[model samples]
Target: MSKIESIDAKAVKTYARTEQTVSDVRSYRLARVIEQLKISNCPAILLYDPVNIRYATDTSNMQIWTVRNPSRYVMVFADGTVISWELHSCEHVWDGVDLDLELRSAVSWIFFSAGHEVESRCATWGAEIVNVMRDRVPGESRLAVDRLDPMGTSYLASKGITLLDGQAMMEMARLIKSPEEIVLMNESLRAAEKGIERMRREMRSGITEQELWANLHYENIKHGGEWIETRLLASGDRTNPWMHECSSRVLQKGDLLAFDTDMIGPNGYCSDISRTWTVDETKPTDEQRRLYSTAFEQVHFNMDLLRPGMSFSEYSEKSWKIPDLYLKNRYSCIAHGIGMVDEYPSISHQVDWTTAGYDGVFRSGMTLCVESYIGAEGGTQGVKLEQQVVLTDDGCVPLTSTEFEMDWL
Candidate 1:
């Protein structure tokens, strides 16, 4: 047996074979997609987003580049039929991962490829999609689509297809985690910790912010982690405004460095973690200490506040209320769902409820990140802290293992 096939389902089921061929994560995720399709009354989903495709079929090709290209795609029917298309050379790429999926050469009708023939080529792509939907899924004209170009959209619409929100269904399905997935996620989290540890060891007065940030990427890739979503590492003054991408500026001994490791780690699970640290052997300023303490308070307070049965609105209402000094520069949401990427239910703050709030219940098996960014309106420095956790009947079990700078306080 191959390593993926030999993996113990009780141990690392993520790489193990699916139920159709053997048993484990590939089957579990596909079942989640099917369950979601049925709940949404969607006959099938046409997946163009590489992340969605990866979630559905356990396969990939040029993941980042194809995000905007739409050249690679898949169709997953509610009845459990899966058909995928990729570059001709990649026809056998998925091989043993999903035994039931049919693979073919994907159509490329983007302007870059088709030029003057974009329309006609798009029509051909649309017709093939419709034919497959009719033949495989049979009666449903309603197709859930993650994304499509205008030509493809108009063409599919003219042919009596109603495109439901596939991304919503996928997000809903992804919010809850299976036991097996947690294992893979923890493995990815370990990769991130290795990366963070590298950063901590190399952190010093003379190191540039870019040099520090590169350590995270190097550790992630060296350990089989795929990518980091953001370049959010800053020291000293750059920390004050927040969201500053890492730069080449040399650091000073007492500077406060902050970063968010939006890493898409192994098995495509994300480790969206953040922390602020002091550069080298220097005493933190009183202002710096205050910021770290406040941010930590917010993160832990909200992390403890959440429960399995609480509604999203109630959670927000009773959640950590940001004080006046730090209100303006709050993190976008108290928390958000995490899976292959930042997935669903971005719980806004109470002040943001008027426009951004939505209602839902926090449920068991859902993984979340509690967030905090503390900086006064015109402050000179700030602290960003976040914790990744999974909810169960007991309470939040932390996925993040990085120790906070508690000694600084």
Candidate 2:
């Protein structure tokens, strides 16, 4: 059974309260989406993404998440009441909510053709629910589905349902972090810290990147991070050039390792961090030491510069010298916005670094990950240091408490 399935109904309710409850975070999201819907005059919004569904109803019913087997759908009315389909597949979706928030009978299973498979039932159910929702709402209520597979799209079109792009609006809604989200993210950070520490203790000269990946990945899940992004470990000279693209290369003496991993927290909130470490006990080369120091300084410099109202591009200018002077890397840029993904609103190039719009201004309540990469003398070997931070009115708050010096191992 899955971690969610193992959760007793009572335990699930208490677990939600232990951190940020999904209802709190998602209620705000729903409010914003509903406001937009009113502006667009879109009567009902169909959410299909797991993240979206979690944001809307705090439920983890996978039967309704995939493009193939959607189990449930959520409908938010202009009056603020939300109706959602209840599915048996969801072990106990309502285990956490206040008892007062009763399930609406009208939102229950909408009948479709019999003898249908799981995926077919999901698609058919989605269409029928939307049709029922349309009939209940005023005349010509524009139906907006968050995300739909091609087959689902064709099915909707057959019924004359209009499709819309809600990515920007949804992303904008989730950009800010709530106190509860911050708590869960912090929990994830702790798990990441523990996993990295484990890697440090077990690492050896012959350890391969793939092996290290498995070590950190498994440890994270064992430590309460239910979902983890791919582990990236590039060692030796491989670290300098194609810094990304996880490889199966083995570790070697004097190899500099660079990596970044994300730990999934409660309710899908995430925490990501990166570090550079060296293998073997030999004294580091002067060049290697200098490059590592530069990367560390860059991460600190960017973190210190964060604050509300500061344009992201303006901050990039402050660290332009590090790349040019230390790494001989002239491509200086602003840091990216990070939340659901590592790259959101990717950094601005030096050419446009001074521009205002591209490098969005920093604001309180936003989370960002600052990473610095440096290649060996001829762009042959590279090193990177990254950390998660939450913007505060004064500056920024570091999510992971790890140090830059990877030698702590």
Candidate 3:
């Protein structure tokens, strides 16, 4: 049986590196979206960010964009199927992936920013895209968008574009794993593990936090890592601050060094992990040991609580207070779902559930990172643990093999 139940891990590994074609991926993905929407006719999607662009068009070409200025807006349809135009005149038009010329020419409008083609140029491109989508898609045709700024939403409303919250639809689409996506995510997990191990080995006395970050990044890159989302390395006082911002402080004896990083794999999927270490030459202090154990317990506790059909807030409240009750340490909530960013859905609190924007039930095929940290001494050196897990029918499966333990070198 494969480690991942739904798909064959080995077979996925074989096709993982065929050099994905953006057009093919986009075409397939758009088909999937169309099927999900149950729309018989074709509908156009306007993409702006690289992430959304990658999701929609399957092309990572940065040039496919349009701007709105001087009361006239342009839309880059990329395909008549959506009825928009392709924006021309991007900074790196040459860098576009080799796509069909006909497909490129099908782009409709190329509205320029205020002054680019003419003086002082400023453009709210997303608003223009929404407006165009509203104008083109018939009132009966359901239009979907990933996210829209308030201004963009208002413009869509004015243009009569029926806004079907894109996040909800896209979240459903992204939550379930495709064969290709799973393999890429697995590759990202492997790279993160390698980076973690390298950091463990290099965590020694006298090492600067910046140096540790550099070492980890180098290792991740050396092992086919594609791009780093964040390079955070903090020590001592910084660690206790929960979301401790990374600094240039040097590690020393008794310093608890905490590092958190997330990166995109070769396939453009995301991998996020965090760990903390103490630089003591000998045994750690009593306080340090206590804090570490508290964090470890919570990390495992949250993992055990994860499953299908459970409410994120219900489970979160149940487990979030563990630190305060058991360890007598008060801190922010630990653990959250992980995907393309530092924090995401599939894991959230009751407040999040009721507070709007992020309340949802835990389901199979979602990925999350169970995280916990314990601070000491008015907010200084703290112990932390973070592990990535995927929701399964039975329970959850961890992506990385190594346990959350500090390497006191």
Candidate 4:
């Protein structure tokens, strides 16, 4: 039996909380933002992306809601000063206290006024931005912006302020994690493992795929998780082509269930883990065993090839080659960097380097997720496995601890 299956549900929960501890996560994350500003040669950054704002300012109010409406934003100067703007009434969510940064309510007049609302709001918001820039940034200083609406863009154009790609800069900064960040990531991984344990206990024939997926969501939220990234959970024939999300399909006596937990846990760090299991009272069929073992071998082989100072090109060239039959339906990337969820520096297959790959040297402190999927285009089912690891001075260390389903192997 796998280590996860061997443990009882209560033991799994205890293990998840064993190493939980507090750290100065805010300071560490701010330091990273400062480092990014220096590297990118920007005087300040205007962050519209909620994730980047959360990283720079260490504050969040209705994060998921902000993704669509974007009712919040943050401005961080290279001098370490931060200003956050949120919806006026939503300030109560933070209990009337900002966490380690200046907080202000956004201009909500557009909501109350109807005539020329967009133009008026944009102009007013532009004036506020100009005022902040005058105070925090010098004359003719270049500003980086992650994203902006059309109105905001037009206003900035009128102001003649240059905008750089602040999203790329933030991704570069997040590529390597700090000690405190690692602590939060470890905590997140533990929470994810607990969720996986719950799924293992609940997996069986006659359960709907959505029901199984709900088990993970319930466990994660109960353990202080923020949100799950995707719904890529499938069983039976849905597992063959891959990328199939959870549905109402009921699992049968002998079916392969595959899922990827793109979980954003405590402190906003992401834990990207994938596991495949068999929903059977007896052992898996020979075809099922072969597929599972191939995927397992692929994951470990690529993980073993990881080391500090390896070039992305070199790794891509030397990585495992999926069989011809399985290559057609292979996942987009063999491995990808993960911090806030698939950050940067994706290592694609060697054949795909010229088209879809990036060039960089893997450095110590970089965290990555090795991915594997083995299935034929017309096959009945497939197996997928992924593991999270961080590069150390000598070798890579695992971040996720959930074991592979042994019964399938």
Predicted structure 3: lDDT? 0.57
The best candidate in terms of lDDT: 1
Which candidate, 2 or 3, has the higher TM-score? 2
Tens digit of per-residue lDDT, candidate 4, span 1-409: 3232233323323443222223355666777888889888888898988888777765677778778766678888888887878776766544533345677877633443425586887788888988888777758457899988777877887787888889888888777776556767877888899888888899999889999898888878888889998999999999989999999999987888899999998768898999988886457889989998889888888888988889999999999989998998898898999987788888898878899988889987788999999999889899989989877765566776688867655
Residue-level lDDT of model 1, residues 1-409, one tens digit each, is: 2232223323432333234432466888899999999998888998999999888887877788888788989889888888888876887668767447787788899988889999889988989998988887687799999888888989999999998998889898788787677777877888899999999999999879999899999988887888888999999988987999998999999999999999999888899899998899577888888888889988888988898899999999999889998999888899999988897989999999999999999887888999999998888788999888877765677876689988876
Q: RMSD in Å for candidate 2, one decimal?
A: 7.7
Assess candidate 4 and give its lDDT: 0.80
Using Cα atoms with residue i matched to residue i, what is each candidate's TM-score against the true structure? 0.94, 0.77, 0.74, 0.90
Positional deviation of residue 223's Cα in model 2 after best superposition, in angstroms:
2.8
lDDT, each prediction: 0.85, 0.63, 0.57, 0.80
| Model 3 misplaced regions, further than 4 Å | 1-32, 39-44, 61-113, 116-142, 147-157, 280-282, 325-333, 342-346, 349-358, 376-379, 406-409
TM-score of 3: 0.74
For candidate 3, give the lDDT of residue 304. Answer: 88
Candidate 2: stretches off by over 4 Å: 1-23, 26-41, 61-73, 83-88, 98-126, 154-160, 243-245, 312-333, 340-344, 351-359, 376-378, 406-409
Question: Model 2, residue 251: displacement in angstroms?
Answer: 1.4
Clash number for every model?
A: 0, 5, 15, 0
Positional deviation of residue 126's Cα in model 3 after best superposition, in angstroms? 9.6
lDDT of 4 at 221: 88
Pull out the clashing pairs in model 1. Answer: none
> Candidates sorted by TM-score, descending order?
1, 4, 2, 3
**Model 1: CA > 4 A from native:** 1-23
Cα lDDT tens digits, model 3, 1-409, are: 2234454323434445445633444455555555545542336444444454455434443322221221211222324343223445542432454433222322221233332422111124444454455565544434565544455555556656666655555455556554455556677777777777777778787777777777667766787665676656778777766665556677888787777777765455677777777765447777677778777777887788877888766776776554333343333445666654443564444344455434568777667788776674465567767787777666667766755564331
Q: What's the true lDDT of residue 141 in model 3? A: 36
